[model samples]
Target: MAITDEFLPVPVPESLSATYLVPTARGSGAKPAEAVAALGERLSDPVGDLALQMIDSPLMTVDTRPVSQFPELPPDLLAAFGATPGQLEQLRTANELVVVQAGYRPGWPPVHEWSARAVAAAIAQSLDGDLIDVFSLQFLDPATALRSLPDNDGRLRLVDWILVPYSPTDTGLWFTTKGLRRFGLLELQAQEVPAQFTRAWGAIMTGAARRLLRIWTESLTEQDVPAFVQLPIETTVTGHDIAVAYGSPERHDSAGSAGLRLDLDPATDPDADSFLTLLPPAGQAAAPAEYFAQICTRLFGSGQPEIRYTRPSDAMARAVETARRSLRSARDRFLIGGLPPGVQLVVKYGLATDEGQEFVWASVTSWSNPGRIVATSTSDAASDPTVRVGTPVVVETADVVDWALLDGRGVIEGGWTQAVLDERL
Candidate 1:
C-alpha cells in the first residue's frame, strides 16, 4: 500500500507536543563533527525535499554499515533502483551516513515529499557517490502492526509485533520480542518488493521515531509483560514512562495529570520501575481474571499467588526483567535465527482436580495445526524435557515456552528453555 497523508508526519498542535525525525547521513571518511556542520548547512538554506524549521541533535555513531551489507539482495531489487550491484556497493561503503534526528516545527511538509530514496540520493550526490536506494530502521506502527495479529481463542500464542533496538553495526531488520526470530512478523527489509513499486520513502522515515516510541510503549503495557520481573530498584529515576503516556490522542487518558507525567511514577515508587525507566504494564481491563490467574500460575505455580505490585522481592523483579529481556534477545538472534525443521515445542500445562492441582512440562514432537494441534510425546528426555504423564496434551504457540532462566549458558545452547518453569516452582 502507498503511504498517503495518513502515513505522513502528523501536524503538531501548539497545545500538544510532537517531534519530527529524518534519517540524516554523511560519507564514511567524513568526521562525525561534519554531521553537526551539515545540520547547520541544511538549516541555513532549508533546501531539500524536506524543509526544516527546527532540527534536533543528531544520533551520531560510527557503528553503522551502509545498505550494501543486506544479505542476498536480489538482482531485480537492484535493477528497480536503476543501479548495478557494483555501483551500489561502491556508494554504500563510501557513504557511511549518520542518521540525524530533528525536532520538526508546525506545518512541516508531509514526508512523502522527502522520501528515503531522495534523502539517500541527496546524501550520495553530496559525497560524490552513486545514487542508490538506502535502507534505514523503522518500527512498525502499532495500529498498523497489531491489525495483522490473529485474534486468540484464550490460548497464548505468537503475537505480531516488532520491538527493534537500533544497532548501527547490524544491517538486518530485527523484531526484538518474544517467540523465536524465525517467527518474526516485521521483516520488512527482507520482503520481495515488486519491480514497479514506488516506495513512500520520506513518509516512512518521518514516521519511524514516532512508531518506535509507540512500539516501546506497547511492549511495556503488554499484559503479563515479563520485563517487569527483572527491573532493579533505582535510588534515582532516569527514563521516561513510555507506557500509558504513549498513543494517539484518542488513546490518551488526560492532558495534564501527575500519573500521566513521564518521570514521576518510577521516581517516587520502586515498584513502578522499568529498567529503562518505563512504567510497568498497567493491568488490562479487557483481560479476564482467569487469564491473569493462568499467567500467575505459569510463572509462580498453582493457587495463583497474588504477585505483590509494590516493593516486590529482588528475585521476583529480576526474574520478570530476565524473562522480558530474554524474549527480546531471542528476537535479536534473527541475524542467525529461523525454524529450520525438527524443532520441538515444549509446554508447561496445569491439570486441576478435586484432589488438588499439579503442573507438568511436556514436549510435542512433529507438531502441526490445521485447525487445532494434536499432541504426542516421543519420550526422549534430551531432545525434549521429560514429562511425567504418558498422555499427550495440546497447547498454543510453541514459542511461548518460559525463557526467564535462559541466560549465559542458554544463549550458548541456542534453544528454548523450561528454565523459568524449573526455577519458579
Candidate 2:
C-alpha cells in the first residue's frame, strides 16, 4: 500500500526489532536453549510464525571470544536518557553482555510486537537483567516490561507499540512518535504546534495507525484524511476534522525514520483539539484519549486508584501572556481570522474566583468598543451549572482571556487555551 492524499499507508518496515542489553546473563552462563524453552512454555497457544522464527534462529547471543563487548552510550547521553549512575556503571563495564533480540518479518505487527517484546522481556526476567525502550529513553526491569499474551478473544493492546512525546529541539518544538516503526508503520509527528496539542496528537497519531490498518484489512479505497480533526461534537466520523502529510525526517536527530506529520496549519488545528476523529462512517464515536486510557488501565492497573491530574507547569503560564498579546489581532480580524469566509467567532472570557481563574468559550452575539456581546454558550463547560449550552446569558467581557475564530470550514485562529489545557492533561 502507498500513502495517498486521502489515506495514509502503513509501509512494511525495512527492519523490525526489540533490542535489550542484558548484563551478567550470558557471562554468568545462561543458555539460549533454556530461554527459548521457557518462552514456548509460557505461551498459551501453539507456536505460530513468530515462534517458528524464534525456534529456528538464535534469540540471545554474547561474544564467545575473549574480547569484551557491550552497548556503548556516553555518560551525559545516558544521564539525559534518565539512566542512574548505577545503570551506567553496569552497562559500561559488564563483560558478559547478552543482547536479547526479537526480529520479525514484514507481514505482522501486533503479534510480532507482542511476541518479540514478550520473548525479549521474558528472557531478561529469567536472567534477572534489565531492558531499555531505546526511543522513549527508558530503562526497565524485566517484570515491568513483560506483557500478558493475547487472551481467548485475540485482543491485543495496540497502544503499547506507539508513543508520542512533546519533543522540543533547538530549532523548533515538535510532537513525534517513538514506536510506530516497530509495526513497520511510519512514526507520526506534528511540527510547531502548541504544547497542549501534544496530548491530542497522542490519540490522533495512534488512531491513524489503527485507521490505516483497518483500511488495509478491509481492502478499502483511499479515504481522505480530515483537513482538521476535531474532538467530535459527537462520535460521528466527519472526514474534515483532521489531516497529516506523509514525509521524511526533517531533523538530523530523528533516527531517520519515515513520518506522518499532522497538518496543524495555523487556522485549523489550533482549536480542533481532536475530540473524536477515529470513528468510521456512522460508527459509534470512540475518543482515542478515552479509549487508550481504558486500554492502559486494563493492562497496567495494580487495582490502586490512579492519580490523574497535576497542576499546570510554568510553561503553561507563559502561554497566557502570549495569548493576551494576540488578543488585539483577534479583535482586528473579528469576523474572519484573516484565513476566512468567516464561519464563526467565539471569544474566551476568563472567570476568576477564590480558587483560580477559568476561561470560557462563548459565541459573539454583539460587539462593543472593547467588549463582545456573546450569546448562549456553544458549550456547557461554565462553572455556573445554569449556563448550559443554549442558555441565553448576555455575557459582558470584562476580562477577555483569549479567543478563537473559525473560518467556513472550521479552520481556527487564536485558541491558546488548547495548548495551555494540554499541560494539565
Candidate 3:
C-alpha cells in the first residue's frame, strides 16, 4: 500500500497535550559536569527556539536564584518562566505562545534511582501530570507506565485515548484497570530509498504509528482469545464405486480403529431422495464387501475412531460435481497442517502452457502415522511441460515419520488409506 495516500493530515485538536520524558545519565568515561555541559550545549539553541515558539506573555520574574551576585536571568527568560494565569489568558487571546520551566535539586536516594526518579518527576511536573511507578526493572513496564487520574468520586478514570511510542525491544504495550493487560508492539524502519520517496516514507511512518495506536487500544476489548482444539475434515467420492481407509490410531480403547469406507454422501447435509438415485446399481461390481469388513476390523483393532460414509443429498452431490469440474483444469496446490504433526502439501503438474514450462519440483513434509490426507495431486498439480513420473512422489519413514512426496507428472490423490506397509517392510 502507498503510505503517502494512507496518511493524510488530520485537524489538530485545540487542547493538544503531550508529555516529553527525557533521561540523562553519566556515561562510563564522562564526568557529570562534562555530561551536563554537553547536554546544555546540544539543547541550548533548540530550547531557545522552543521557548520563543511556546512562551510569549507579560508576567513577573520570580527568580529564586541567589540575589547576591547575579540578581536574575535575562528579562525575556524570566518573563517566559514566570507567566501568570492572567498573562497566559491575555497571550492566548492574542494567539501568543507561553511555556514554563522550573528547576530543582537533582537529588536521589541512589545515583541510578535518582536518575530514573528525576527524569520521571521532571516529565510529570512539566505537564502537571501524575508519576506512575514501574516495579519491573525492564525498560518499559506497562503496569506502572502511566495511569489516568481518578474521576469525580475517586473512581479510576479512563481517558478517551492515549498516544504511545512503539518499542521494538518489548512485546507490544500493556496496561491495567483491574490488573495488567499487554498489547502487541510494532516496529517500523525506513530503508534508503530515492529522494523522490521522502514524502512516501514520512507517510509510512505516520500510518504505522496510527495503526499501532489503534491496535493497542482495541486489544482491550477483543473477544477471540487463543485456545487449541482439533478441527475435523471429511472426504467422499461420488458417481463411482470407491474405497476409503483410515490410518490413525484411536484415543480410547472403546473407540473404533481407523479405516476407510465407500461414502455415497460425504457431506453432512444430504438430500434423502435425490441421493438414493446416485448410489451404485444394486448387485453392480463394487470393491468386495470383505474389503470393508477388513477395514472395520483393522480400525477396531487399533482402537481408532470409526470412519463413516453416508449417502449425500442431491443438492450437495451436484455442488461437489460442479466444484470438481471447475477445478479440473487448475493444478498447483498448497496445504497447511495444524498442531504438531505438522503436515504440509504442495503439488505442481507438468503440462505445456503459453506462459512457461516447469519440470522439476520437490517437497518436504512430516506427519503422524495416521495423519489425515490434507491434499492431493489432481487438485493441486499445475499445468507445465516438464512432466516426469515416479519423481519420488511420496517418502515415508518409521522412526521420525518425516516424509516427502513429489511428482513431475500432474497426478496425486490419496487420503484415509490403510497403512501401506510396516516400517520394517
Candidate 4:
C-alpha cells in the first residue's frame, strides 16, 4: 500500500545532527572546516553535499564546542559498546566536540543521514577521533561510520535511534524516539505495554517513528498544522497489506479503547521530550486484543491467531541443515567481533511441540559456542498458542534451523533456509 499522510501543525526538523568527540591532541585530525569542506568531495551524490545544503534549511555547519577539561568515560557505556583502551583514552582526553548538521532532506530512506554520517566519519578519520550518534546513542569508529550505504540498507540504523526500554518495576515498557526529533517531531513514548509484547512493540514502535518521519518529511505545506493528526501506518501482514490509524496521543472522548493511549507532549514540557503509545483507528468495530493479535501474527509469524506452514520441502529441509552446518563460522565471527551497532543476530530454533516442532526466531545474546547460544524469542508461538513472546531460550546447535547475521542496512550472512525459503516457499 502507498504511504499516505495527514497535515499537522508541528515544527519542521531544521537539520540532521551528529557529534564527533575530538581528542585534545587533534593528532593529524583535519580541522572541522577542512573535514566538512572535503566531505562533499569524498562522497558521491545521493549521500553527498546535499546533507549540508537541502532546501528550506541552512548550509551544513561544523562548529567546535570546546570543553575545558575532558571527563572520564562512563563505565557502562565503555563496557556496553566494547570500547578499546585507545578509544577510551581518546574519549577521556577529548577536548572538544564537533557538531555537524545538514539541512533536512525529508524523504524516503533518510539518505541524508548517511551524508551526516560520512562527514562525521571523515573528520574523525582525519582527526583520530570517535563518533557518537547523538540521537541513536550508537558509537562508531571511523571505519564503521565510513561504511555508509546510499540506499535503504541504512534504515537498520533507525532501530537504534529508538530507545525501547521495558521495565518490570514500572509495569511499563517505554519507547523514546529521541532521534525523530532531528526531524522536528516531538519525541514519542509508549507506557503500560505488557512485558509479553515488548519484543513485538520494539519493532512496531520503531516502524511508527520511521513512518512519522517519512510522513512529516513529505508533508511540508504552509499551514499551522492541526492540533491532532491521524496516520495509517502500514506493514506486511501474512503476505497481505494492512494498517491501522495512529495519531497524537490526545485524551480520548470515550472510556473504552482497544488501542494505546496516544499522548502528544508539547515542546514546552519543562522536562525533556521522551514521552511515547498508539490507539488503533478512531472507530474500528473489532475488539482491541483480537485486532492487534492479528497484526502481531502477521509481523512476527506468531500471535494469538496464526497460520503455520508446518512442512518444509525436501530442498528446504536440506537448506535448513546447511544453516546448521555453517553455525560454527557465524559463532566464530560473534566470538571475535562481538555484536556491534547495526548488527542483529537471530537463530531459529526447532522446539518439540505436541503437534510437532515449532520453529521460532530468537534474538541471539551470546555465542558461548554453536551449541550453547543464549537468546530471547522474537515472537509468540508460531503454531502453538500456548507459547509466549519474550521467552528466554537456550539454543542448542542440534536444533538450529538457521542463523542470520544482519549487519547494518541491507547486508546479511547465513540463514541458508531463509535464502531458499523466499524462493521455494
lDDT of each: 0.27, 0.45, 0.24, 0.52
Candidate order, TM-score descending: 4, 2, 1, 3
Candidates 1 and 2, the one with greater TM-score = 2
In model 2, the number of clashes is 13
TM-score of 1: 0.23
Worst 10-residue lDDT window for candidate 2 reads 236-245
Candidate closest to the true structure, highest lDDT: 4
Q: What TM-score would every model get versus the actual structure?
A: 0.23, 0.46, 0.18, 0.51
* Per-prediction backbone clash count: 13, 13, 31, 15
> Candidate 4 lDDT, tens digit per residue, 238-319?
1111122122123222222223334445646566453433544445553333344444444654432122445758877888
Local distance difference test, candidate 3? 0.24
Kindly give the stretch of ten consecutive residues in candidate 3 with the minimal lDDT sum: 239-248
Model 2, residue 108: distance off in Å is 1.7
lDDT of 2: 0.45
Candidate 2 residue-wise lDDT at 340: 38
Better of 2 and 3 by lDDT: 2
Model 3: residue 206 alpha-carbon error in angstroms: 6.2
Q: Write the per-residue lDDT of candidate 3 for residues 1-425, one digit (tens) a residue.
A: 12242222121111112221211121122122232233332223433233233323221111111123322223342233333444333222321111112221111111222233223433333323323222211121112322222222322211112221211111111111111111222222322111111222222233233333343334323234222111111212211111110111132232332222211222355642111011122343433222222232333221111122223345434543443343222222322322111122332222234544322222322223232321211111245222212122332211111122222221133211111222113
Candidate 4 positional error at 207, Å: 2.0
